[model samples]
Target: TAAPGPQLFLSLCLSRLKFPSDLDELRELAETLKFYKQEHYGYVLLLYCSAYLYKQSFAIPGSSLLNMLAGAIFGPWEGLFLACLLTTSGSTFCFLLSRAFGKQYVVHFFPEKVALLQRKAEENRSSLFFFLLFLRFFPMTPNWFLNITCPVLNIPMPIFFSSVFIGLIPYNFICVRTGSILSEISSLDDIFSWGTLAQLLAIALVALLPGALIKRYGHAHLKVDGLDGDGRDQAGRHRKRR
Candidate 1:
């Protein structure tokens, strides 16, 4: 029999691969993929990027595993850069896909969430970018939810891309760095411990501060809808007699 071509070799490799569901499985998967990467560097890179983008662009979960795989194959700095770049690119693709085709479905399925986000967006319109950064930095926030609903919230594309790219640096760094020391990890909790959560929460709060200040102090000088001469919202004031 002739030697298998790169495609056939890749197919055989993928057939043995499964998405890791736990620490041991993740370690095994990492080792297997690392060997393949050594043997077929270009094909492995393409495969990894495609998988990452597919999950992100379609809002599928399980990015943590991919980040670790990147670190195992490419080392810390390279993996971090690749993870960050792919994340931004994939998220922007999601944003565009949602804008073009998923809007109606998103609105119909999550009407209340859409309405809530719209109100929040209006409330933070002055410091919208900071508000977005806050959302991205907040660990409890569901990024997939934001990705799908952002278009309906009328968030500008530039702001969306920049926030996703810059605001997620810490998060991506944590994952990729953890991947560098994967052999030492015993559980998922090791990747995001209480201390890590606290740090992320602190960053989120700091990101929110600028938006809070703008909402408090900048409203008076800006032209705001449904606000009166005193800068109090019109809804709070009693109507004048005709």
Candidate 2:
């Protein structure tokens, strides 16, 4: 016979577990889950982390919903911390997976995109970490695309992890904070208002500025191997090196 404790837990989860599709549904689901979390904190935490990592590792969409859910259940600061940690860890898993198995497929299916990203990466190689942070900070940038392509671009794991962890903080904070006030929010649009977008854009610009300066002014001082005068590599004799 099944253990009563495990059986009860599974039954309870099955009865209440659901994914919210809209703002109304999200509010309802959050309320339900928050109550359940109070009674089964450990189980709820495990379930949330598992679902979050799964979505992140697989490049699934809808993380915004999960972020809000975390806030509703865990409150703002805790939720933000959890979201950032999961985002970085899950993105790292995706990056490693892409490196191991998806490289050829990504290159074959998105040849032009891969080529464009490669050029951009090379152009900012001197300040590649800041460039990555800029991409993460920009709300419009597709993070899933970056997660899968970073390995192909030969971006180091440490830089990729740090950029994701730090760069997505503002975005995550917004989602978590909105979640904490779930009862007051009427629409998803409110979470990402024009003001929020402008702030994200401003942060992205700031992140890119360091890279721009490094590329323009620090080149003459940086000693890179296989580079000739004017900072152009021997392989790309005419192209300016980063």
Candidate 3:
């Protein structure tokens, strides 16, 4: 008998690469998994979770497909829960790894940005939670970059974890639910329609508002204090009305 591990791993990678686009093929794959679901549901879940974690830890690019599979296989609520769990755990692992060993590489690749971002993160440590929420919710912000940068920026662990856990819920909800209706999707673009984009952008904007307002207010207050100082100080006021 031939050892089947390599073949199985290759097939898994190929299937992931061919995801949603090859609906018919995915349907067949799903049916095969369904047989396993019948015989050993626990095994299926373990494989799925491990694969998700592996992809995240390695910076692989097929998580969106896995998100959909979560819904299609486990149903919306279960899929949503699993996706959130895997995303948080996997992202945290990546963050810690980057913190441990990614500084020199990031500095080499993005010399200017690394120092500037580190300074800004240190200056606005108190507001990192909102900034993180905005980044996580905003579609344009890449999760992999955030994962690498969060630790590099020295963002607190609690804020980073909480932002990911909470900020990702809305988008995860959309993705996991989309999985349930994968049969109707003709292309991956359908996963994120304009309306959906608007919703995510709106959430990101809301998350960003407090930080923006605070920054604006601080600047304005500084300007006002500077203008006041130009006129007179407490001792000057006591000396004369001029």
Better of 2 and 3 by TM-score: 2
lDDT by residue (tens digit), candidate 2, 1-242: 32235457678668966667777787887766666666677777898899899989988777889898888889877998999999899999999999999999778765666666677789779888877776665432378878988899999999999998987776777777667767445688855778556645664665566556644543454322222222222213311231
| Pairs that clash in candidate 1 | none
Which digits, one per residue and each the tens of the lDDT, describe model 1 over residues 1-242?
33446887678766876666676787787776676666677877887899899989998778877787777678778998999999999999999999999999878866655666677678879888877776676532367778887899999999999999987776677677656667445678875877546645654665566456645544453333322223121211211210
Which regions of candidate 3 are displaced past 4 Å?
1-26, 183-242
TM-score of candidate 1 against the unseen true structure: 0.73
Q: Pick the winner on lDDT between candidates 1 and 2.
A: 2
Q: Model 3: per-residue lDDT, tens digit, 136-168?
A: 655333576567777778788888888888877
RMSD of each: 10.4, 9.6, 13.9
Q: Judge candidate 3 at residue 65 and give its lDDT.
A: 73
Report lDDT per candidate: 0.72, 0.73, 0.65
lDDT of 3 at 233: 37
Q: Candidate 1 local accuracy as lDDT?
A: 0.72
The stretch of ten residues in a row with the least summed lDDT in candidate 3 is: 222-231
